[model samples]
Target: MTAHSPSLTPAFWDASIARAEKDSGVKVKQVVAPSTGRDGYAKQLQASGQFPDLLQSITPSQFTDGGLLKPYDQSWIDQNFLLPQGNAIKGKVYVPPTNSQIIPLVFYNKSLFVKVGAKVPTTWQQFLDVNAKLKSAGITPLELGGNDPFAAAMPLTGALSVDVLGKNPQWIQQRHAGKVKFTDADVVTAATKMRTLVEKGYFEQGALNVSYADSIKNFNAGKAAMYPMGSWYLGSIPKDQWNNIGVFPWPSDDGSVVVPFSVGGSMAIASKAKDPAGATKFAQKWSLDPKNLKALIESDGAFPMLKNKTLADYHVKVSPAFTESYTYVTKTNTKVSSMGWATNDEALPGTGNDDFYAAAQALFNSGDVKGQMAKLDKSWDTATK
Candidate 1:
């Protein structure tokens, strides 16, 4: 079966497939899916007529619209997929999401927090207060990789919308359907928070030029007190610095937690798979097999999408940092998926990812929250109409 994913290196993919093959006795063929990104992959799938046996990065909506993916029967994945709110297509399971992964975590240096005498901030105001204190201590309050621009805005965007969207997860679908506009007051409120942070100098100076890797390095080197990033950053952090780091959810207005979907790469069977049965077996084994799933969680910091165990059974055993983050996730009953997921390629025209990313960057640079909202609303209308 052909597969494409950005999550695993070729070596890791080969090794994982070999292990799955050995355990499940499923003869899986590893064919190239695509070298291009998500949009490119979609086009390639269209050109090829037959979708790859498995795809990563591409969403269910794209495949479903193209009539290239097979729906799943009732199984553990069908029941447990957390972001079903965004992922399902007309009540059908087309994209069976694998390992659960949380994003936009406020990863901070514990030592820095203690040095500043700051408690974990539970609300937006408290969050700002802690940053101000950190800045007073001559530490960069937040190390952001703004050179890559949109990618840098992502974590904060997730943080800002969690409170607004968490309470109204369907706002994403509503916006796509043109029932809601991007210029809505609530949308503007959530977006303006990031502009406010920039205006107040809560992030490091010259953040607009810093790359994501550079931001991570700055945080690890003690140049900053906090770094908002995805849980995937876990694998990249050096082991020696592990004890000094702690992760928490982005503080909300009322201290209520709002988390976006924590899904890792999803797996879907191509309608044209040479080994359809093998593809299904591999998908089930990769997700449900306790041994494989645990290894993925430990090695990659992937949250288990399958909720077969208690918090103690799953998170505490992973690592100190993961335990902290996942504990918040389970305890808060955090909502999955966000506007970030809303603007994918298959998204309604004006609501595509490029438009969303551009809107986010412009907010930080221009500080015209309302104006940006108007522009975004216009873009949505133009594209969706």
Candidate 2:
């Protein structure tokens, strides 16, 4: 199995392997893969004739397109999976949904807000004001891990969530169907907001040099006032700092809560597995295993994607910050597919996510919102062709 490197610790993987071996009688080996570039590790392994039997955390679209993945039985999926169609490619289930997460959440430092006399912001202007206050107090207004392309793109994703998907959840689908372009007014506004933050010097110096792990460490160590990240960040916070952190949805211009979220971390089986049936059984067992699910929730702050399951059903203690964000999303009932993430029906073609990330990083550094948008449109067109 190819697993996301930071998603779980070594001990957790060891325990999971033991559990799966005991339950399914199939030995499991995990390869920790870097969480940079779109499915680069998987594609590299496939090119070298060393692709694993089970894939985790890697987006399956390219593999599915190449007929390298085995499709799951529809009846089995219907009986077990909550979002049965979440990882479908061309009317077939290529990956089994494992968990859900709300991306683009602003996990902020509560003490920093108090120190700067700033309150949680609900509108776009208020959010900027809060950042200005934090900056005036000599605090880095935002923490970003720009060394990792995905992390670098997150702020833009947050902005786009509010300015684009918040108003029209179908924006991605429209773009996919050739009815819209990245240069559209709403998209330009979103990109401009992200560039505004860059121009205001709201992010930490040398953010482009910080790796994802170090950024998380810096945020937890109180070096930054805000970290705009996904809900999964809830599990990465140290226990002692739990009470000092708070979360809010990415602010919108009109102050309405609109979260960008996706059901993620699904696994796919290789079509050429030596033991296809055995691999399939193990995938099912691993995904639905109670112990595995509990560990994932406790360590990754993952929301379950199984039928009749909720975070409460896991019975694991979570930080209050997570509860607040989760409650806010649930109450608002306003969520859209997170841009650049592969959803059930809206998987980006080829290296579309990589292109989007590259464009976002360029915008973050140069503040060329229009040029980046045009670059993204070009890349999108090329990928589709």
Candidate 3:
């Protein structure tokens, strides 16, 4: 099978392939993204006159609309597969999702917090109190880079909504369906809280221009006290940074906890796989094989999509903080962003993601939250119509 991905280096891909082949016994042909970027990986694939056996990070719309896919028989995947047990069935079991991953966590710098005598802020009131304490100690409470402009606003667009408003992923669904108003009170409240945090100097100065990547470094560099990101950082961060990192859920002003979804399923097999039958078997093995993922992903803080023993058993032993964050999202019943590949709006590139950024920016600065929402409603109504 030809495997491709962005960001991870060719060496990393080679190592991964070696690991996969050694474990599974099938040699995987690696189709890595260009050394620089994915300017046209898909076109490059077509230009090369061959499609890989698998493609991930390429979304559902691309699968259905790009004509790059050839429909595979689902029954085939089921008969032989083992792991991600059934993430393959987003719609028609078209492809199997390899490893499920989570995103957007609220992690604190333990050393910094200890130095300031701050507790990991569990409650919203505590968050504010902690912010005040950090300011007095001359520590940047939160490190954010907005120079990328929209980077600092994503957590607001994503997590703060669930935390400050309510745990309703459907608002995003409704907005996409043209069922909910973009300027609704829920959106307004989240925006207001985001602004409050910014105005109160919770984030670092010069944040307006900081990049998210740089902000992450700043957090690790001890320039900030807290970092709001996802579990993927668990793997990426250096080991020394681990002791300083403490995970927590997004703090909600409301009684309900903020909800977050692991970005999406990890791997999806192509319909036109050279070894479609073997590929399905590989998918199952990658996800469900206790030897492969169950113990592996859990140790790394990845909450699997499969509810199998790997997660069920490992939850028995974990750091109290990560456990709580996992439990909160679980008990509250987290959901994926409906406007993402899960729904129709994803068909329009830069439409949903771009529109959300604008809405978040407006809500952050505006005095009249509902009025801001009202404007969004009018615009959304026009766009959909």
Candidate 4:
């Protein structure tokens, strides 16, 4: 109800708030966020006083490489934290994302599949086959929100066909890295398949323009059978529609297998925090401490990553398929890349989101495949430089 940044409100802060006040030598104070979005949030911070005990959810480049973060106090971490390595970074912790929600799978209605006498898809070809049947039956096979390019890019996630055809997630990353040519068969073919989905009306009408918020609403409203999203969704969508919710990995060509998903995207403490110890304490509490976890879930319906029993029991309604989906992702042999969308270099280049989106928009909108990619190569070349 308050105007604070939704990000800043994570219950974990309750711990740090307590610690900061007890020490009382320092106060972690901040104005709630702007009415506007991200850019305004950053500008608001830049315009203010000396750094507070913490700056929640800031980019690593600003707080880390820039010497803005004070390396985490390993002592507190050793006592209170549990995480995979490298999370500590060079030193200071900042903000770490803890609870998560489930991402959705684009599933076919089994009733519909049976009526049409079509098998639910297992491989890439099978998925397409199901789509064809759905079209003939006059129930749209998939719902897409093209109104927002961010949402539009989401469906391609299920096409593990690219990974299947290309052979693995590693191959995709290598190619994205310039280590493997973008022209390689795996990347190219994957691009082609995604483009095909667009051509086939696999997504909802006017999808190119759909806002990310509306895209999910449309899916749960039964506008689409499957949506590729995070497990965190379990906490947010309505209970009535909960029964219809089912999950599968972004399916591999054979819907049976999955590319293991790495649990990435947790938060870190800011090196810049005036109260590094307090921030560290908060991050840990925010992660799994009982009081904070309950606050987050009951208030926001966020998913817990800790496997803490208190949180576990609270999530029973949504855990089965949701937890398993995460297991399938982590089950793979591959190590998730250290970063992707999380990286500053990828996101914060000179022209910022504007310049990057211009390229992405061009690629997604271009009707001709070859022309689109050639343009993509040119855009990446410029953007990366």
Candidate 5:
């Protein structure tokens, strides 16, 4: 079995493996994979003919296109999974998602907001007004980590959530069907919004040099008024600072809530496993195991993807920050899959995600929105072919 490390800690894997061994009588060996650039390593293993029986945190199509994965039983998936066919390829479910996470959630420092006399903004214009106030008061409006290219893309993800997906929930599908391009009016609008933030000096100085871990530290220390990140940021907050933090979905144009989320981490079975049946059994058991789900929530603040399950169902103590963000999104009932980090059927094809990240980094540095959008279109066309 392969697992993403650091985020999905070693203890989490140990607990899940212990449960699978006890329940299925199958011994599982774990291999650690980096959270970023995971697909490159998986592909290397595939080329060496040593791909593991079970894989986590990998893009499904990278393996599905090569006929390397075994499809799950649709009936079983339908019975247990909230997103039963999320990562399906041509109507075949290859990967089963384990949880869900809202990306581009704006987590703000409550004390800093109060200090700057800024209220939580519900509309895009109001959000900018808050930022202007923070800037005028000698506080950085936002915290960003651009050195981790994926981290650099979060602000653009928030913009896309409002300017693109909020307008048309099927934007990704439309791009896949060649009905839209990154240079289209809506997409360009999103890019322009991202550029405006940079040009206005909203983000902290040297953000492009900060790593993801360091960004979390800086945010906790109150160097910035807000940090736009995933809901996973909940678990990273220091216990002492929990009461100082609050969260809101990325603001929309008309003040209607639009929370952009995606299936968190998914697992897939290799088609060439020595014991296909045993592998399937272990995958099924591990995915829905209460022990594993509890660990995921406590460690990463991930929402379980199992049907009829709530964060409270785990019976674990979480900070009020988590409860506030979770309750807000659920009550609004306006969740949409984030196109920037999507992993299911809405995922970008081939090298599209990597290209998007690179393009986003360039946009951050140069503020050349149109050039970056054109680059994305070219990259998309090449990747699809």
Candidate 6:
């Protein structure tokens, strides 16, 4: 009955738990994990050997590979989960997405577009044209949270990956399989595209030092024309300026690419659940029930993955920007995870993630497209090996 911090709890969790317990007549106790780091939580789980019946915020890979979770039934994933990458890892449905995530979108100030006399761009060339117009009008064309390494890489990789790796959606798996290299010409093109943006002064001043919150503040204050982030950002916009908000898919060379879909939202059931049957029922309701899923999506500004479910199904008032991003998700069939998803040690180094973020920081700051990529390739090879 233990869980992640209440602050980080998903919107639908408490209600779902209450409903599940009422239906099943099982009294559940909620234990809060210590207010410590992720690894500390894992260590605590191990030392206590009391893995919560319903695990939250942990990926399937982390739990399954660690021998802490039971592999989920394939039928459960098939009938209940609308996973972006399908519902299996290594041919087993160990973990499926808790909710779909629409990432790497460019949210813009519609008024700024009007002032600069630019339409929402659909092609890479048009995107550059719009950037020029924004700059000419004395507006920062892009507001990036560069001080936060992952934030800096989100839009860069999102746009660049589509242009460079769009032809191969499974490029990450391929790279891991030793069938491709990060030093490919297209990969360099993608990395260099970001350098080109810096060279053109399209980004806001001191972007290299700005935090995500700072970038959001700058964008909302009308200091920038475009802010590229995930759909989750919709709720953070100030109500007074909400009407001026709009969204566009990141433009690509031929307009054939779409935003890469990622599924970071997941919950797993521990193998050592005290009441296995009850835990299974709760997990199913939390992930599969259309009503609960809808709440999660609407409340968190995530893309819905329920069968035949669309944004129209949720009748709540939502920002136009959210609707536009969902439309993009529905229209585009091509999707992918960021590169680090494939690289094992791909998170921030000390936090049990990896070194990719730091390497990406080098790429952005050094503008040494080739040199940085070589370093990245070496790191990836070592990690995958």
Judged by lDDT relative to the true structure, which candidate is superior, 3 or 6? 6
Off by over 4 Å in 4: 1-27, 35-49, 73-94, 97-120, 157-177, 254-256, 259-268, 290-303, 307-326, 329-340, 343-365
Off by over 4 Å in 3: 1-29, 35-39, 43-49, 66-90, 93-95, 158-160, 163-166, 273-275, 286-350, 358-385
* Candidate 1: residue pairs that collide: 1-29, 101-262, 260-337, 261-336, 261-337
Best by TM-score: 5
TM-score of structure candidate 1: 0.86
lDDT score for candidate 5 against the true structure: 0.81
What candidate 1 gets wrong by more than 4 Å, as runs, is: 1-7, 22-25, 33-46, 79-86, 290-300, 310-318, 342-351
What are the per-residue Cα lDDT tens digits for candidate 4 across 116-210?
Answer: 68765667787777778777777767765655654455444334223632265354344347775445555556656767776787766776677
> For model 1, what is the error of residue 170's alpha carbon versus the real structure, in angstroms, after optimal superposition?
2.3
Q: What are the models' TM-scores? A: 0.86, 0.85, 0.74, 0.73, 0.91, 0.89
After TM-score superposition, the amount by which residue 242's alpha carbon in candidate 2 deviates from its true location, in angstroms, is 0.6
Cα lDDT tens digits, model 1, 1-385, are 3343444557656776777777778866565655556656655656976456776556566557667888777555547654443355666666565456666778888999999899989888999999899988888899888877555666446754586677676676777776777677877788888888889898889887888788878888989998877776666566787898888877788888777654444567777777888887777665554544555566667775555565445433455787776665556475646455532322435355566677767766797788877876787778657
User: Which regions of candidate 6 fall more than 4 Å away from where they truly are?
Assistant: 1-13, 34-40, 84-87, 289-299, 312-315, 341-354
Tens-digit lDDT string for candidate 5 (1-385): 4655664677767877888878887777887766676778787888988898888767787778788999999998899877676556677877776677888889999998999888999998999999999999999999998889888888888888766888888888888789999999778988788788888989999888989988999999999999999888888888898799999889988999888877754568999988999988888887777667776676787877787777767777777788887775446556677866777667776677777778767877786788898888888788778
Model 2 misplaced stretches (Cα beyond 4 Å): 2-53, 272-278, 328-332
lDDT for position 230 in model 4: 44
Clashing pairs in 2: 86-344
For model 2, residues 1-385, the per-residue Cα lDDT tens digits are 5454454667777887788778888887777676565378888888999898898766776677688989989998889876677667677887777777888789999999999889999999999999999998899999999889999888888888777888987877898889999888879988898889888999899888899989999999999999988778888989998899999888999888887877775568999998999898888887777667776677777777777666777778888887786675445467777888756666566677898888878876686688889888888889878
Supply every candidate's count of residue pairs whose N, Cα or C atoms clash at under 3 angstroms: 5, 1, 14, 49, 0, 3
In candidate 1, where is summed lDDT lowest over 10 consecutive residues? 341-350
Question: Which ranges in model 5 have alpha carbons more than 4 Å from their true place?
Answer: 7-11, 25-45, 328-332
